[model samples]
Target: MSLSIVDNGRELFVVKLIERGEKIDEHVQREIMNHRSLKHPNIVRFNELRNLERGVDILVATPGRLVDMIERARVSLRMIKYLALDEADRMLDMGFEPQIRRFVEQMEMPPPGARQTMLFSATFPTEIQRLASDFMSNYIFLAVGRVGSSTDLIVQKVEFVQDMDKRNYLMDLLHTQCDNGAHGKCALTLVFVETKRGADALERWLSMNGFPATAIHGDKVQMVS
Candidate 1:
């Protein structure tokens, strides 16, 4: 990573270039999904003067937010005593590492020994662990439960049927469930098709065959940051 310095009086912005991973790895996506599962505190904000006046001790935010707050602070950096990263591994993904590293470099965070630094994650690969070493001293590494068993932990049934038999198979399952009175009238079964066209076709097929079906596709979430 290389940092290019840009200076002005009121606002200072440093742009750093970090290399992105060559291939899109499944592990990184899984880590991000797991990290994003914490929906309770999706956005955390702190009032600047109120927090400082009350002697606020703890704060949590994304790296970008933290860096912005720190840069816009009126006090010195010595006030920041402790820093912790919730999901260190996922934070190192493309378009994120540069900001994270820039914060560590620009923000006058106390030395590794003077200030406490903690890293927590579900899956910290060897490379991420090595990268995290630059921000820690004698950190105690802890690994709990079984590792590399996320997929195995889930019990899923896999069946391959002929492409032409899919519609009939689904209809038979729906008819059997309705006949048995298992789910009242509708079971709310979620069907996932591979492509958007396939989903549209399946939705039409189900509705034409006297079943109320709907297909949903995801849209990009608009985040302020």
Candidate 2:
């Protein structure tokens, strides 16, 4: 959606606020990759305050960082044409309402009718609705699938394996998938473990067994490529 807006060839300043937590660095790296893949000169590359000084057509930031930049006179919201909040509920759940309100209400951002505001979330609660009411005007509510029901697109399966045999079992599963022609990017798999050490161990085991894999966790510093 953002890419499409950038492709529209209009000079517009857009701001996207995201949730801040243990995964904030990972999220920022992912966003940076997405922006770089576009190779659009108008798309601002995130280099902390340096790129921001030249002005920004699009700014993706966490509420705290954005507020700090604003307080330091590094950026202004007065000319913001579009404002977006990704994972709106998660940000509120993380107790970011104060910062969000500060930037959206207390800052120099244009009023609701003057600027476009969008909030996206997997689930919307009453608090989110109140937030929308306070920050948006004449907005349309869009819902996909049922409110509390899971989508039919995902298939759920459960299996029980002994702890001692778990590695072998996973190997067998991977072998089966490969035999069925799931390779390259299509063969991507995400395995969640309880601890960072466990993730590292699993990654090493997979690499030793000839299955390429990388482990991502909060302890690792993600590099933008």
Candidate 3:
């Protein structure tokens, strides 16, 4: 569910899923577990899932679980031609910068010429931009328009509710939207909650009320949304 499904699964975009308000939930837990089990040349693998006192830590490696796979002689990165970070802003926001820095630092003492580094984000802040600049070489700011702009093709809706009733409101809305031909034949609904704990609570409540739902948040990882 964290990955967006498009064109009948022809395109799979598992961008960084952010749960701004609540804590961890079953959905996030399952995704992390599933990702750990997946083995592929293009997939990112998480090996050691650590829950420290400060936060959760995912020892994720692009292409494979680097530390263990290298030791086990499973795969090699000799043919890797490019390095990319999807949901980069979310990664930094979730506190994976140190791990990322360490990974980049271990890139074999740097080869001749510049190793192309690219960053794409839905929202960019001045401070984050500065940090990204520090990590890249000869990067150019290539934004086309406003920072948090929306698309014309996308219809938007905004609703106001008291903080105490937000959860209930969201549940009611989801129920109504999904009920009997309202959402038009099994359309997936994406709900964005504020915190990891809130996400956990909401998913539980929805499930208890017989609504199929899931949530993902920072508390489930070594980062924060």
Candidate 1 residue runs with Cα over 4 Å from true position: 1-55, 74-76, 151-225
Model 2 over residues 66-92: C-alpha lDDT tens digits?
Answer: 788889898788877777787888788
Task: Quote the RMSD, in angstroms, for model 3.
Answer: 11.9
User: What C-alpha RMSD separates each model from the true structure?
Assistant: 13.1, 7.3, 11.9
- Candidate of highest lDDT: 2
Q: What global local distance difference test value does model 3 have? A: 0.49
Candidate 3 off by > 4 Å: 1-79, 107-114, 148-225
Mind giving the per-residue lDDT tens digits that candidate 1 earns over 1-225? 111111211111112221122111122333334343332211113344554434332333455655666777732355555555655666766456766776765677667787666666677788567756887887788888765456566668887889999889989988877777755676667888898788888999999998899777532233456
**Best prediction by TM-score:** 2
Best-to-worst order by lDDT is 2, 1, 3
Number of colliding residue pairs in model 3? 14
Clash statistics: count for each candidate: 0, 0, 14
User: lDDT of each structure?
Assistant: 0.56, 0.72, 0.49
In terms of TM-score, how similar is model 1 to the real structure? Answer: 0.47
**lDDT of candidate 3 over 1-225, digit per residue (tens):** 253211211111213332311122333344545454332212223332222112222222332234334345443333333344556677677766665554455533232133444566767877568756766776777786777777778888798899989877877776566665554553577877767788898888878887777777644555448
Pairs with backbone N, CA or C atoms under 3 Å apart (clashes), candidate 2: none
